[model samples]
Target chain A: MFWQQLVNGLTLGSTYSLVALGYTLIMGVLNIINMAHGEVFMFGAFVGLFLVNYLKVNIFVAMAGAMAASALLGILLEMLALRPLRRRAVSDLAPLISTIGVSIFLENLALKIFGPQSQAFPAGALSGVQLQLGPIRITLVQIVILGISFGLMFVLRFWLSKTRVGKAIRTTAESIETANLLGINTNKIILLTVALASALGGIAGVLVGLSINAVEPTMGLSMGLKGLAVLILGGMGNITGAMLGGLILGIAEVFTVAYGASSYRDAVAFGIIILILFIRPQGLFGKRQGGRF
Target chain B: MDIILNQYYLQIVIFVLVNAILGVSIYMTLSTGQLSLGNAGFMSIGAYTCAILTVKAGFPVYLAIPIGGAAASFISLIIGYPALRLTGIYLAIATLGFGEVVRVIILNLKITNGALGISGIPTLGTKISKMLSSFGLSRFGGLTAQQTSNLLVLVVLIFILAFLVFFCTRLNRSRVGRAFASIKADESAAEAMGINTTYYKLLAFALGAFIAGMAGGLSAHLTFFIGPKDFAYHRTVEILSFAVLGGSDLIIGPIVGALLLTMLPELLRSASEYRLMIYGALMVIMMAFRPQGLISKETVRFWKRKLGRRINQ
Candidate 1:
């Protein structure tokens, strides 16, 4: 039972890791939380859903479509909500509120388009094959989900380490002023980072939609909060911490449902976040003690 | 008088007043530069306490309301001490988590009826009627029962507003307010100057909670129902918009914001379906053009200088 639950937790956690990766990346580069990232994720899921349901496209093609659409959305969000505020040199909280406005607009727009109801993906999209390893049972879709998520994480890691843009992102994250001194276009880097992070969020949304078999406008609300919790738990701006935090949160929630009252399952992520805030405000893997949030 | 006293209009006015109070509640904490998203949770605490006292405990509405505010204020102190350690978005996320925890707990507790919520709350209108009759002023000024109830609520709102105005003016000039402003301007500077940042932050947080709690108590009686969904993250965002869109710099900013934003939906009833969308667009536009909000110190000062000179002439 424990092993089966662990498998389920990993599947759930992988999606969380994807979302948190987006959060960590944005926080690292911009020092601001993109409140609309969750909406971007939701939009991605709807894009993938539209392709799969209406066009009967393969899952891989739908994911690519979703990623491209969401990347576009990220750029639009920057132009409409963030860039203006940054140019104006508004208060620190201005961008946060602006992103919130974008989130609200996108959410309500989706509600209008999607009719305020959960859209279910037609079944049998993935091959129905269960693999039994000793006492545990795993579905073929679960294996595919895990593979795709881990594969994406590795790709992200490699790109960040090897690519020129990746080094630029890391340098910008360290100090924007210094990066500018080095002649890197900080503005372009910020834009690119936002798009990349938003792409990850979008793909995660599609994966989650597939696993859950339903997608809705309101799906972003809970997922957004949980992603934030995972980001904090893993240490803000720590890529590896976000991944670990996601898995831990996923497992903890699964255990709560399996052994404890199922109703408190939602509380697990939030409860852990509060406890961590009290004991270790810097988070578990945070290197700096009191750096910029 | 008839138009002003109309039940529909009066109800709207009452809401505007209550939301104004909520706006001030958040403004209290914002002044200290702490971005708390837990005001809605504090409001729930106040609403539930007042509702239960009236429904199950049979306490008077007058007595239960203050107690509710007190209850929320007390809880704020407990959380503020530790949570204030984080800054910026981290503080925001922590408060957001705290709110969710409060909501989840309420959803599971039996006393909260597990999402069924508390109903059958006595309306403020009936209480006013009872009080007027006992004083043999039931027909005082020949007012109707509905008008009397609304008048009572308005009186409460007026008193609260008056207190806020006086309190804000005094705070702006007082030592504590300077401490708050200093902390907001630069915490390290304030600490270096021997100002107790923690103590003042806690005070602002607690005061904010109390006001929000009081607003919640009034709302519970007005609506005659209290539900977990009423105090969710959506509400937090709405209250936040009230302050941000209005202008947090002045005491009147949030009140003006509440008045206009509350009346906006009514004015644009034709676009009711698109109300939130419009609101969202407005927020983005406002942030882009005038991030200081609809009202700010400079605007107020500009008007004051113009009007003051005219009045003197």
Candidate 2:
């Protein structure tokens, strides 16, 4: 039972980590929380659904298309909305409010375009396969999700550590002004980072949609909140921190629900965040920076 | 025309007034460099307190409203002390958690009546006897029930509006207000200058909560109903939207925002199902175009200068 719950927790955590990675990347680069990220994830799932149901594409191809489309959309959003604001000397609140606005706008737009009803992706044999390893019974889709998520994380780790652009990104994350002085194209790096993050969000959305077999407009708000909590838990602006945070949250939630009441799941998650804030405000893996009011 | 000015319209107008009160309360904290996402929770405390006291304990309605408001203010003070120590996004998150916790507790508590919600308390319209008597009218004398209710609502709204205008003027000019402005500008600098950041932060939060609680009491009285749904996260978001869209710096901004946004769904009734979506989209566009807000006085001055240049050309 413990193992089953642990596997379940891991699968859930993997998806959360994917979403948190997106948040961490953007925050690391721009120092802005893109509230519309969850909406991007939701849109990705809708795109995946459309491809599978209407175009009869394979699941892998559909997910890939969704990720690509979401990335393009992220770039468009940056160009049309975020870029112009950055050009002007605006306060940090401006971007926060603007992103929130974008979040609302996209959610509403999605509702208008897709209608309010929850939609399911086209069903397949992937839904039927459940593997029993001793006392632990797990879905094939859960295993697949875990495997794909790890694969993506590995690729991302390699990309961040090994590439020139990756080093630039790291430098930008460290300090934007300093990175600019070092001859890095900070703007281009920010755009690239946002695109990459959005793609990850999209992939997570598709996986979550497939796992749950339902998609809706308001899913973004809850998912975004959870991803943010994970980001804080692991360590803000740290990819590895986000991963660890996600796993901790997932496992904590699973165990809490299993032992306690299901109603307390959300409360438990929030309680953990509050406790973390009180005990270690910098988060588990986040480096301590200069404190300000 | 008479029907148009009757009970339903009176109800909606009262609702608008209540929302306006809540909006103003939110504006107070926001202007002072703090964001408490727990406005709805404070409102709920006021609503529930008033309802429970008036109905169960049989307290006079006259007494209940102030007591309710005070209770909410005290609660805010407690939460604000520890929570406001954090700044910016952390404070927002902490308050958000606080709001959710309040909601959860209310949902699970036996006194709250849980999901079924407390119902069939004494109607709020009955409590306006003193005001009516002062105007040479007894309770239900020389007026229909609808007329009496409308008068009660109108009187309460006028009273609130007067209070808000007075409060705004005082806050915008006072030393404390200047301190708030300084905190908003730069907290460290404010501290360096010998401002008690902790005291002022708590003051802002408590004051906001008191106003919100009063609004909640008025809302419960006007509607003759109070439910958990009335003070949900969506309502908190809606209040934030009002403050954001209108311009947080000015006192009247929330009032304008609440009036416009509250009536917006009714105007767009044709697109009823997509109303929330449209509202969201409108907010995004507004943020994208005018992050400073719709009625930012600075932006207005800038625009005026540009227009003057065009005229000179």
Candidate 3:
């Protein structure tokens, strides 16, 4: 039972970590919380669903297409909403509110376009293939999810450490002004970061949608809140922290639900967040920046 | 037409007044650079307290209302001190979590009647009371189903709203208000300048919650119903939208925003399905074009500039 729950927790945790990676990356580099990110993720799932159902595309191709489309949407959101706001010397609240507006707009648009009912992706391809290991049963899809999530994380870690663009991203995350002085195109880097983060969100959404087998316009809210919690737990703007946070949250929730009431799952997660905040507001792996609240 | 006059218009007026109160309540903390996303939760506390007191405990309406507001205010006072230490987004998240916790508690509590919702509370919507207050007759007794009475109640609420605006405007100019402004500008700087940042922050939250509680009390009395759904996340978002869209920095902004947005959905009832969509789009456009809000002092200044040029010509 413990092993089963652990595997379940890890699978769910891996997906959350993927989404948190996107959040942390954008937050780290741009110092902006992309509030519409969850919507972007939802849109990615829709795109993937459309590709699979309408175009008869393979799952891998569908996922790639969703990621690409969502990346474009992120760029568009940045150029149109964020870029203009940045130029205006507006308050931080302005962008946050605007992104919330954008998020609402997209959610309602999705509802209008796709109807209010929950939509299910074709489950035959992903389901009905369970892997058994001594009273612990897992699905083939779960294995794939874990594999892809870890593979992406490894790739990201490597890219951040090695590549020129990666180094630029790191520098920008550290200090945008300093990165600009060092001859990096800060704007381009920001756009690139948004694109990369959004793509990751998109892919994660598709994976999660596949695992859950259902997607809806309102799914973004709960997912977004959880992702934010994970981000907070892992330490804001810390990639590795996000991963660890997601894992902790997922495992904690699974164990709590297994031992306690199912209804208290959300409460348990948020309670943990409050406790963490009380103990260490900087988060588990977050570095404290020198900014007055 | 008689039915419409007796019911629909009366309900509309009451809703506007209640929402206006809610808007202003939200604006109080917003103006102080604090964002408490738990207004709806506080409102729920007030509503449930009033409803239960009136229905179950057999309290008079007037006494029950204040008790309801006081109950919510008390909760705010208890939580505000510890929660106020967090700033900006952190504060928002904390309050939001508080709201969820409140909802979950309400969902589980037996007195809340669970999801079935409390019913059969006495109705507070007589037309004569509304009419008398509308005509500036302040001291009239509560009216019956007469049209004039409904108008009176409406006018009285409006007067109450006006007084609140006046009081808030005055408070904004006071030393305590300046302390709030300083904290908003820079908490450490405010602290450095000998401002009790902690006291002022808690005050802002508690005051906001108090007003929201009052609004909720009024809402419960007017509608004669109280339920958990009335103070959901959507309502919180709506209140936040009113403050943001109207301009959180100004006293009149939330009022204008609340009135306009509240009336907007009514006007767009034919497009009910697209209501949220349009609202969202408008918010995005407003944020993009007018981040300071519609009734912001800057917007007023810009309008004055245009008018001044026209007059000069």
Candidate 4:
């Protein structure tokens, strides 16, 4: 039972890591929480669903299409909600609130278009092959989810480290003013960061939709919050921290459900977070410093 | 049209008052430079406590409501000290978690009826009227029971709103208020200026929780049923929008925000299907154009100057 739960936890955790990576990337470069990120993820899932269910496209094509759509959405959100605020020198909280507005708009738009119901992926969307390994059961879907999540993370790490644009993004994250002084276009970098982060968010949504076999309008709300928690757990802005934190949270939740009463499962993630916050406000991996205030 | 006596309008007014109270609660914490997304948790605590007391413990609405506020305030004190230590996004996320935990606990608790919620809660006016009549006082004796109850709720809500608005305006000018302002302007500078930032922040947090609790107690009686869903995460955002849309800088801002926002959907009922979509878009445009909100100090100042010049001319 424990081993089976562990595998389930790892599968769930990898998706969380994907979401957290989106959050951490945006936070690294912009120092703002894209409140619309969850909606972006939700939109990605819907796009992927449309491609697969309506057009009969394969999952890979659906994912690529979803990524492209969500990347556009990310750019739009930055342009419409974020850039104006940044240009106006508004309070730090303004962007957060504006993104919240964007989130609400997107959510309602989705509700209006999709209706307030969960839409399921077609049966046989993936081959239903369960692999039993001596008392622990695994499924083909779970394996695929895990594989895609790890693959994306690997690609992200490589792209952020090896490429020149990757170095530019890092420089921008380190210090925007410095990056600009060094002749890097900070605006373009910000746009790229948002697009990349949003694309990752979109892909995570598709993975979750695939695993759950259904997607809905409100899926982003709770998942987005959990991603926020994961971002905090991983030491906000630290990519590695988000990755490890997601796995820890996923395992903790799965174990809680398996051993403890299932009712306490949701509470356990937050309860552990509160305890951690009391002990380490900077998060487990975050560096200790005075708050931005 | 008899707007005041119209049931729909009266209900909207009552809701506006309740939401205004909640918005002010948020403004209280925001005033001290703390962004709390957990007022909904405080509100739920108050709602459940008030409901349980009134339904099971046989407490009167007046007494039970205060106790509810006290209960939420007490919980805030327990969490505020440690939670307030973290600033900005950290504090917001911690409070968000706190709200989720509160919701889950309420969902699991038998006293809360475990998601079925508690229904048939006696109206605040009926209970108060009965209690007063028993004491040989007949404040609402002339009207029908429904009208009496509606009027009583309105009067009581207005009374509380007046007290809160007065209190908030006063607080805006008091020593603690100045401390709050200074902290918001620059926390490190405020600390350097010998202000006890921790004590003040906790005070603001607890006070905000207290107000949110009171609003919850009052709202519990307004609606026939009280459930965990009433105080979900989205409610927090809604309350925040009230402050954000109205302007958190002035005492009148949130109240104005509440009134307008409460009435917005009603006005948009013609396009009911697109109500939330429009509301959301408005928030984005409002933030984009006037991120300081609709009624900042500058807005008041600008109006004051214009009015003063026109009067002189």
Candidate 5:
């Protein structure tokens, strides 16, 4: 039972890590939480849903379509909501509220287009294969989910460390003014980072949709909150922290569902976030002392 | 007066007043520079407390309201110390989490009636209709029971808003209010100048919760039912928007913002589904153009000067 839950936890955590990376990426460069990121994830799932339903594409092709679509959305989100605020130099909270506007708009738009039902995720060939390894049962979809998530994380880490634009993004995140002085195109970097993060969110959304076999408009709300908690838990703006945080949150949630009531799943996740905020606001990998949440 | 006090119209006016009270509750916290998005949690505390008192414990409405407010304020006081330790967006996220926790707990609880929610509870509207009938005002015969009930709710809501306006103004003008403004300017600077930052923040948080609690108590009595779904995070967003869209700088900002925002959807009834989309767009546009909200410091000062000059005249 423990091993099975662990497997489940790891799988769940992998998806959360994808969403958390989006949040971490935006926070690293923009210094603001993109509250609409969950919607971007939701929109990505719908894109995949449409692709699978009409175009008869495989999961990988659908994922690519979702990534491309969501990247455009990320660029649009930066151009419309965030860039204008950056231009004006509004208060820090203004962008948070602005993203909330975009979130609401995107959510309502999805509701209008998709209606309020939970649509079936086209799992394609992955649905019928459950692989049993000794005492534990794992599925091909779960393996794919983990493999893709880890693969993407590996690529992201490598890109951030090695690529020229990656260095520029890292420098920008360190200090926008310093990056500007270094002659980097700060606006392009911001847009590029947002798009990359949103694409990750899209991928996470599709992976989660496949794992659960359900996709809905409101899927983003809870996932968004959980991803946020993971971001904070791992330490804001820290990629490795977000990964560890996602794993920890996933394990915690699975244990709660196993030991406690199923309804307490969301509460447990949120409760952990609050407890972390009180006890160690900086989180595990954060640079500051205990009280700087 | 007959046309104005009709049931539908009175219901709208009553909600306007209730939302205005909710606006002030959030405005209190926003004025202190803590953008707490958890007033809905406090509201739920008040609603459930008041409902249990009146429904199960058999307490009178007048006695229940203050007790409900006290319960919520006490909870806020306890939660604020640790929660207020976080700064900026972290604090907001913490408060938002608290609001959701309250909802989930209420959703699972037995006394709150779980997802089905508590119903058939008596309301202030019922009392008002009784009072109207006993006074023979129903002899005028044009006022239906619904209208009479709605009128009572309107009266109660107006009283609540009036008291809140007075209390908020007094609180904002006192030494505490100055400290609040200073904190808003810079917390470390305010701390260096000998202001107790934690105490003032807790005070603002508790006061905001207390006002929200009071509004919740009244809303429970007016609406005649309370549900867990009623106090979710979106409600907090709506309450926050009253402060954000109206102007967080002045006392009247949230009140006027609440009034206009509440009425805007009603006026644009032709495109009901699109109203929220428009509202969301408007928020983005407002944040882009005028983050100070519809009312700013200059607008408030200009009005104050104009009113002061008129008084002098």
Candidate 6:
């Protein structure tokens, strides 16, 4: 039973980590929270659902289309709402509130367009295929979710470390003005960073949709909030920290449910976060913020 | 005036007043240089406390509401110290977590009715009816006793809002308000100026929580039900928008925002499905064009001058 819960927790944690990456990346480079990111993820899920269910496309094609669409949206959001605010040098909370406006708009738009019901995937490996192991059974959906989540993180790490754009992104994170002085296009880097992070968010959306067997418009709000918690717990703006945070949060949630009431799952994640914020504030791997951000 | 006493208008007026109270709660913290998104949690605490007292403890409405506010304020005192230490987004996020955790605990607890919520809540609607009958004004609008009772909620709550407006205006000009302003501008500078930044921040939370608690008590009685879902993150967003859209710079900003947004959705009820869409778009456009909000002192002066000229004409 313990092993089974652990597997389930890992699967849940991996998906959260995937979404947390988007949050951490944006915070790392841009130093702002994309309050609408969960909506973007939800939109990605709808796009994937449409591709798979309506167009009868392969799952890979659906995933690609969703990722591409979400990436485009991320760019547009940065350009339209955030870019103007950043240019004006508004207060720190301005963009945060603006993104919320954007999020509400998109959520309502989705509600009107897609309707309020959850759109389910047609019968596939999602329901029928199961993997049986001794005392620890997992589903094919779980395997696919875990595989894709890890694969995306691995590729992201490699790109960040090995690619020119990756190094440029890091430099911008370190110091935007310094990166600009070094002859890097900071604007392009911000755009690329949003796009990459959003792409990862899109991938997580599709994978989670596949595992859950349905996609709903409201799916992003809670998931997005939880993902933010994961990002903070792992140390805000810390990549590897976000991953570890997600795993720990997921396991904690599972154990809370296993030992106590299932209704307290959301409460437990938030409680752990509050405790951490008070005690450590900087998180496990994060340096104490210098009050600049 | 007769139409004003009718049920439809009364309901809208009560909602406007309740939302205004919530808006002012946010405004209090905002002025103190903190962007707290957890007022809804405090609201829930007050509502549940009031609901339980009136229903289970059998306390009178007048007596129970104050106790509710005190309970919520005490809880805020506990949450404020650590939560106030963080700046900007971090503080906002911490409060957001608190709000969610509060909601979840309410959902799980048996005392809150575990999501079925507490219904048949007693309210001042009846007292209002009796008072109106005593004044012989019950016959003025041809309103039934029940309707008069309902409209009484509007009158009593509007008076509460007026008191808040007066209190806040006075608070803003006092030495404490200056402290709040300096803290908002720069905390270290405020501290260097011998302002007890911790005390002022905690005061803001305490006052904000007190006001939000009262609003919740009134809300539970007005709606006749208290549900956990009613105080979810959705409410936090609404309260935050009031401060955002109304402008947090001046005393009247959030109240104006609360009144306008609450009435806007209803006025656009013809569009029905497009209501939230329009609401969201307006917020974005408002922020993009005017992040300072609609009722800054400059704008207030601008409107007053325009109104004066019109009156002279």
TM-scores of chain B, in order: 0.96, 0.90, 0.88, 0.95, 0.92, 0.92
Kindly report which residue stretches of model 6 are placed more than 4 angstroms away from their true locations once superposed: A125-127, A290-293, B130-143, B301-313
Off by more than 4 A, model 3: A290-293, B1-6, B126-149, B224-226, B299-313
Instruction: List where candidate 4 sits over 4 angstroms from the true fold.
Output: A289-293, B1-4, B135-143, B271-273
TM-score of each: 0.97, 0.91, 0.91, 0.97, 0.96, 0.95
lDDT of 2 by residue, A1-293 (tens): 89999998899889889999998888888877787888899989898888888998888998899899999989987876688778777766666666776777788788778888999876682566888899999888898789889899989989998999888998888887899999999999989999999999999998899888888987776788788788778766888888888888888888888987776676665676666676776788888882100
Using TM-score as the measure, the top candidate is 1
Pairs of residues clashing in candidate 5: none
On DockQ, the candidate that comes out on top is: 5
> Which segments of model 2 are wrong by more than 4 Å?
A290-293, B1-4, B129-143, B271-274, B296-313
Instruction: Tell me what fraction of the real C-alpha contacts between chains A and B each candidate also makes.
Output: 0.74, 0.45, 0.41, 0.73, 0.67, 0.70
Q: Clash number for every model?
A: 0, 1, 22, 1, 0, 0
Of the candidates numbered 1 and 6, which has the greater lDDT value?
1
Q: B50, model 3: CA deviation in Å?
A: 2.4
Full ranking by DockQ? 5, 1, 6, 4, 3, 2
- Clashes in model 1: which pairs? none
Q: Tens-digit lDDT track for model 5 on A1-293?
A: 99999999999999999999999999989889999999999999999988889988887899999999999999999999999998876778999888888887888888899999999865453566889987789998899999999999989999998999999999999888999999999999999999999999998998898889899998988899899999889888989888889988999999889986988888987898889999998877787842111
Order the candidates by TM-score, highest first. 1, 4, 5, 6, 3, 2
Error of 6 at B227 (Å): 1.0
Candidate 6, residues A187-231, lDDT tens digits: the string is 999999998888888878898888877799889888888888887
| Docking level for model 6 | medium
Deviation in angstroms for B248 in model 1?
0.7
Judged by DockQ cut-offs, the docking class of candidate 4 is: medium
DockQ of each: 0.75, 0.42, 0.46, 0.69, 0.77, 0.73
TM-score of 2: 0.91
